[model samples]
Target chain A: MNLMMLLEMAADGFGDRVALGPSDGGLTYRDLYDSAGAASVRFRADGGSHVAMADLSSAALPVSLFGAAWAGLPFVPLNYRLTDDELAALASRISPAIIIVDPDSPDRLTGIDGIGLLSRRSLMDLVDGADPPEPEWDMTGEGTAIELFTSGTTGEPKAAVLRHRHLVSYVLGSVEFMGAHEDEAALVSVPPYHVAGIAAILSNVYAGRRVVQLPTFDAHDWVTLVRAESVTSAMVVPTMLTRIVEVLDAEGPDGPGLQTLRSLSYGGGRMPSPTIQRALELLPTTAFVNAYGLTETSSTVALLGPDEHREAMASADPVVRARLGSAGRPLPTIQVTIRDDIGDEVAVGQPGEIWVRGEQVSGEYRGSAPRLTADGWFPTHDGGWMDADGFLHVTGRIDDVIVKGGQNVSPGEIEEVLVCHPAVADAAAIGLPDRQWGERIIAAVVLHPGASASSDELRDAVRDRLRSNRTPDHVEFVGSLPYNDTGKLLRRVLRSDLAHLGDGSTG
Target chain B: MPSLKPGSRFTSSVCTTQVIVVKGAGEVDLRCGGAPMLAAGAAADGGLPAEGASGGTLMGKRYVDQDETVEVLCTKPGDGSLGIGDALLDLKEAKPLPASD
Candidate 1:
């Protein structure tokens, strides 16, 4: 069942159970359900086939989402961060019958014609005006739970259709995987527009637990809420984790928030070992889980649970290193396999493209197929190997591998070494054009505050540590390296901006 | 502050007396002809176009001017009545607070 169905199945009185609230406050499930029902009815009256909500975080997004579900119309939560032109372009693409904007956005979207706009409060008021009967939407049984868009390879974002069945499956499987219970509440810090954010919200919602959402994440607010809400679980990206660790370390043991959290999750971007090391120190009892998946595969396809993490740490064997640096082992539901370019399964320890298939998988993206084979294994566009133990170890994106100077170089490998350096705060490795090496490796690094390291030192530090051709030929030390909001390093940005090579111009 | 861009920067404190709507998608002519520097919340470095500013109260707070074009469309179509205040204010900054370590 989708989250909406679970909400419907949950005792109506349970709506009184906190459905969602900001980190500082809350809303009853009943109130949420009623508001959604009303929004659904109003949506139908508005002649809206689907409703577009541009909220950052509010009781409104959930109300609209569930309300759209109750009404049998696809509820699209447009990213509120996009430029008007981008939003207009997306609206043109989605062609939603109606549009709802956060009161802070422009009343009418430029470029897009005829789409009506409504403020969130006004939408709620419109619901208040209506008689919010428990909505009885015609059951389609085969519709998607949510439609989220991710940056597409075509240079624009494409919507990924996550079916209700897939979402429900993710919820049930993820809860079991994470050892989450109904009594637990999770703190959601990422942008709701991303799959991780949506997963964090829905998993808690369907399980009927409090989802303490921070409208936007702040290091201070995250700790304060965890302390205040007694939040046992948290989902964070690497960048956010670094900040949380810093504040907690500064606050020391008396820092009330650190002790309360039990299980912490890291995903959407590879968690640097240094960051992970610090995280382990900060939340000693909390099982630092590495959740792995993509937008096409719903939320999580693999999970490296805390127990396995312990095993990886305890083992002195290099063979177990995959578990530590792993994206994760496949979850209970999905079937994962590594296949060579010719579509044949590779033996353990051979790198190949990752493919996944399951009920939790979306067969098509938007209306098209981004990954499909004549025989039907969804290509994950990631290069990795599955060991004899069936654990999957992801290296990086298939295209991210850099073959430079007759030697294969994975930027991720260089990044691994750079992040290990004490002075380096964050690092991203990209390839630069070169006369000698064909494709030269260049590293962009962000130094720790009050720390200073020259390109020569950073480069030599990497060389002395790993005697591979992977040492960066050049180093660009800027105030910061460019990264996507999800905390994944944007090597493309670095690759394009590295024309300066050594001169210190930021823009 | 690794996320901040060099050109456009937002203060941690609030900007503007009324609710602010930063309409930046339109091509702008700057000293440099690339992306305007975003205020630092998520994508201050302009690494990702969708790195939206974090919304919540900044400093004191910015009110939702229900009648404003951006506000009306943002909230609900045709419901010129209520506004979201103090929530997501820091996120609504005119420019992204660029990452500056």
Candidate 2:
């Protein structure tokens, strides 16, 4: 059940194929295998409790990941964007660890106590010169394989533990072995700390797809890499897609100049329907996929396939067209159920907490007991519901749901209506404290370039689409909204930013 | 007859084929090259396969028994074909879902 099993199979099945970087010059499956063996030896000799990387995505990521697995150590990838104090704090938590630092930024984490820092180049040199360790690896699935710190947009980050079995089940269930064509390449821009980033490396390697790494995400750089490397596929967050769509649209209405890209998957946050619509129209040749999952879930537990995307877009039925915003159906290997406040399963089309049960779902965090129930369902505090046809729609977090006059109002619904307006490019609806109602809705709208819309008009638009009660009590025009690096809208930030608008007396 | 479970490795006695059981329960006659497959790393009891048993297996292919109850993923390919009891297993079609990662 070790992650090495996957690499071993890849090395044996397609040892000569290039597994990462440019197809012409990248680490082959054999090269990665040997490097991992070398790394395992180094990790064992260093006697480190864990393998941690505070650097950006690079060739060293995969090597360190597999090496840590072969040596039976947890691989921890810390967010490199954190401040020095925050980064040091996280580093201290995983003390007595081997940390891989970006070679260019040698002084990034100077004087971090109780850690062994190795430059990327130095590690690569050691791997090249060292003897390969034995191929044997512990097969027990109980050992921790990865420790990913959840992106704490709301509060302090928690370390999520992923065991070997959880990860193995995810890969074996979702991905077909050597399913990709020899020429296929997957472009990965997400940071190493993200779950999608780790999943991308494992899935692409097993599928025999070459991986092209992008250290930092710039829409222009992403477009250029796709063109330059002949990248056939990519995974991006909603914000990254919006920017990429903008970049492509600025190229003129002719086409998105991404002929090589066959499939594009977006997740990590709620996608604005307008942006995705424009992208579908612009990249006619590419297949669009909307994947939904969390850090606890190995990766994607539910997905909207390409055909579904086109079908929903073309269908005239309002129900079918609306599914374009849905997260599609759950994966064949996963089960998704909606439950109400008291843990009772809700009726069809009822909004409630999203409870999932799957082998890949490890709802366990470090230092805390697993959140799974006695029977095994993990209550993902995310608010969502399933449609009549079984399509799942995720409405932001449950904690963010506004209780307005004893009615549950999802900010996403109101935000959706506001963004649909031609003048509105982006929007966020938050429930501000109100004396009349428990919470009053406030809309923060970002207009499209050179576009304008009055607060009354925006409220009327919401009233037209939904009930008047759902309309925002107040509307504030803004140039931009706050978002974490991973693209999750910082609703908490918005709550504070607009606190002055409502003080139990106002609104 | 070894009990089969997901992730349990098995080796063919008559050929180079090796497999990991993806599904199955209790004791079952999982065979390769018409000979019972051994738990991974077990010593082979007999020599090469009988003339008709050497049908061949492909790397990265999945083999399933009748009624679709038994499934095994071939981690290594060999000359011997996969089987259960007296029936030869069929190559499972590669149903690839969209790459979501």
Give candidate 1's error at residue A122 in angstroms. Answer: 1.9
Instruction: Fill in the DockQ of model 1.
Output: 0.01
In the range A1-507, model 1's lDDT, one tens digit per residue, is 335654553333255566676433466666676777888777777775567766677767777778777777776777777777787887887664677777876554744654667788788777653556754654333576677877553488877887665775565444421123445677887776778877766666655667777888789999998887888788888889888888888887776546667778878777788777767766768877788888878777887778677677668887886478786678766889999878898888888889998766775677786465665468888888888787888878878787677666777778888888889888888776666666777888889999888898888888887766878888878788877666776666666678656333331
CAPRI docking class of candidate 2 = medium
How many residue pairs clash in model 1? 36
lDDT of 1 at A158: 77
Query: Which one wins on DockQ?
Result: 2
lDDT score of model 2? 0.90
lDDT of 1 by residue, B1-101 (tens): 21211112232222211111212222322110112322324332322211233322222112223232221101101111112222221222232110000
